[model samples]
Target chain A: MTGWLSIFKREFRAYFATPLAYVFIVIFLVLSGVFTFFVGGFYERGQADLLPFFAYLPWLYLFLIPAVAMRLWAEERKSGTLELLMTLPIGISGAVVGKFLAAWAFTAVALGLTFPLVITVNFLGSPDNGAIVSGYLGALLMAGAYLGIGAAVSATTKNQVVAFVLSVTVCFLFTVSGLEIVQAFFPDAVGKEVAKFSFLTRFNDISRGVLDLRDVIYFATLIGFWLFLNRLFLDNAREAG
Target chain B: MAPRLEARSLVKRFGPITAVDHISLKVEAGEVLGFLGPNGAGKTTTMKMLTGFLDPSEGEAYVGGVSVADDPERAKRQIGYLPEGAPAYGDMTPRGFLTFAAETRGLTGAARDAAVARAVHALSLDRVIDQTIETLSKGFRRRVGLAQAILHDPDVLILDEPTDGLDPNQKHDVRNLIDGMRKDKAIIVSTHILEEVEAVCTRVVLIDRGRIVFDGTPAEFRGRAEGAGTLRVILPADAVEDAVEQFEDLDEVSAMDRHPTPDGRVRFTLTGDDRIALINRVTGVIDGAGWPADELELDAGRLDEVFRALTSRETDHQDSNQGQEVRA
Candidate 1:
């Protein structure tokens, strides 16, 4: 009802007003590139898929998204700007959504700048553009999930380090749930259930050119759940202040 | 219609500590109410409740009659709040901050531009609007906070320590600025400086130990100085002792103090409600004693006296409450 477009605009531009956006984009691209070309054997694998690049994304974003999102509310709280923000006419939900979208969008821009990886894959062999698109889709959704968790953690404390550490810990749990190393400790039935909930498993399915509705729903629900938690944490902090 | 802002028995507590306790206040349109208190007197807490940043534990605050606890989003539309620290995004420039404030308040297109310009001009913020907030001086930062608080031109303005970091000249400038806004908006400016109340505030509300101890006009607050009224009496040094002794027993006289003078003129402070009546009594006492007075003067009471009288009692009262807290 209120014009949230203004909130959307301001938050979107705030990322670029400082070095935060530039630093984040440069770090994300360099690390993703390193993992894609040098570490993941992008050239040696000779695969028509973006398996090398997609494989490192969950880990890459685990750290990067938190760096981007950690200051979303934590800095606001630290600087006493949360009071200034909360007094504005816009609804809390709108501001949260706008901020989350802006951070996610910044990551998306960084992700898009990695087009050279797609180009390299195309140069070596004809890679399926459809799978590549889905890979990027899964990567973007996973980044959102990570950013949402980061936003939630950022809302909990005024310390950015604490927010970053907590976000990585949460995202790592979600990623490693599907790995045999993590699942081996559990009973067979529980292990499979945990693996089914793994972020990597759902995202891996999409990058394999499989448009599973179940995987889409998993990512969407994870994002929605974490965002809901983000809002709850913000409300608690507001009431606490 | 119902004053610009109202709080009905608002109470805010954190665990065992009560920050704001059963405080109620009203601010009418076009009136500046000076919210006066010492540190930790719940001034910030009360302002936070009014701005909907903190939910009251027991009661409601209304901005333009819209309850903050009931509908904070709606209530925020009618009120502008400058928080205690004036916390702003340090990375953003004043331009960015004001634009964000304007947009968040729902000003659009040219109206938004015009509002931003007016706020910048009103606060004399042009020099630093494009610079990051981290680079601004403390005075400029406070002005930026002021600009954001009034960017929307809301009906009610709640400023917590508005001139805290400014120099005397800047304080005078800000006082003039607040005076200019006195025609159409209700303002609540909280400060530890008692002089600001006398300078710009129409009414004074003194909070102590999370309670309103005094609420009245500046004149009434000054009138509360019973033991500190300045009095002038020009009598010979021989008659001075007799005058001090004779006049010190009046029901209104609380205490007396002599002022240093080279001439034989008697100078003393009288503790009384009516300075004129005290003066008449002193005249009568001195006239019959065959002392010819050369001059008689009655200076007004200073707010410093009122401040000390009220806050000194507050500290003693607060200490007793703290003892009760320890026992509990």
Candidate 2:
């Protein structure tokens, strides 16, 4: 109905316009199955839940979601479509938000395709469906956070590979902030504070069946901050003068 | 009536270098102003600022009387811009791209459908409407970009080199498209092609190094040439010596050159500071000498020469290199 919505529609369709969407979905489904069955040992653990499936999502998205977000602004700039898009009567924020929302929804679709996992877990045993939903919601929010960072980084350069590599590095730091290897570099107080920001730490609680209000608020704030940076970066992305 | 598109003292600076400096002009409805300049003359940068794609370091651009900086959305709504290179979504089909462009401009339902249909028809894109933009020929791709720009029929149309990179027939078709729309919208076309300016523009604004050097009608622009008012004549070989003697006696004739033709005729070019007086004197001398002139013609001046004279040549290499690097 409005500008962002139209932008959203076009960008949402753009994902499927190329092989990017199907390829991403297939890769996601295959790796998801492999990670859950072979590595996480969904069967060997004797657990009837999808915990192992959800456990490997962050790592999978660390590489995969950036692939989606890498093309968001990078391709627009590379193809010179940014000139056309920016000249339209839409707000810069609208364009940024629209593309982000499209990427988020597309990733959600891939996450939704894991319905077989949901059905498989349900058929095997009586698992806590509510916690599973919460886990799914948490995964979606975390992906959005990763996407937010990737979009901002993509806005910084027209090169998609640079966007992808930089986004992976940045996302990696955020994912590992709570690990002891990273904690050794900071003072105890700063180390504890930094640990609170880790995707692994925040997600650990939410995936365990407790949707903490603080965790949700944290993800929301992180997304907002990065998207705000994305808008700023896009404005500067136009060749100066 | 107020001009449909106007810029007031527009200036854009990338750091210390002034890309567009104190540029100002206005285009009323029914006037197609040709923005003529070389590659690095800041034509594209000015168009970008005017279209609200880039902010000016100083000054303002207005569309339908609404300031681009103050009310960009409203001003932009009245503008249809075809940016340089005619960039469009490569993955999108022409049909989808046009629909998306129309919808983004807030055209919906019947209006949107009608707009897209009209643009498709106008650009003759019916055949390629279903093809992805990347797969279409360059001409078709450019037409798709044009269709997207005109989808809303905004009051002001700013096209950056609409015919660039097209074959001659494609160039002709694109000019016809611009000509057909000239009467309804105030259009500004930036091009280095001198022939295109005469083909579609009602007026010419020549800028060089971010400054307006000449702004006038095409004839007036051409009148700036060194030999604009010169006269040329062909005399039979038997009468050439007599005509040369008579021409030298006239006070108005400042210089003259005789060129011998292979057909046993001698051609003479007469130049003077005062065109009207010189024409009168030259004719009197020819009549008095009773010279049989085979052909006599007045030179209207060469557009290429005029273009070169008005625009400085030294700015070519360095500025063009900088312009390309600055564009993307």
Which DockQ values do the candidates obtain, in the order shown?
A: 0.66, 0.66
The whole-model lDDT of each prediction reads 0.84, 0.89
Error of 1 at B274 (Å): 7.1
Model 2 residue B33 lDDT score:
97
- Expressed as tens digits, the lDDT of each residue in A88-179 for candidate 2 is 99888889899999999999999999999888889988889988998999999999999999999999999999999999999999999988
Top model number, lDDT: 2
Model 2, B1-328: lDDT tens digits are 6679999999988887787999999899999999998778899999999999899999999888898998888888898999988999989999999999998899999999999999999889999889899999888887888888889998999999888778998899889988999898999999989988878889999988789989988867766877876889888888877787888988888899999999989999998766667778887777777877667777767888888877756546547677565432
Native contacts kept (model 2) = 0.83
Clashes of 2: 0
Candidate 1, residues B286-318, lDDT tens digits: the string is 677878876566666778778777878756766
The estimated TM-scores of all candidates read 0.88, 0.88
Candidate 1's C-alpha runs over 4 A off are: A1-3, B227-298, B317-328
Q: What docking class should model 1 receive?
A: medium
Please give the lDDT score at residue B187 for candidate 1.
97
Candidate 2's TM-score: 0.88
Clashes of 1: 0
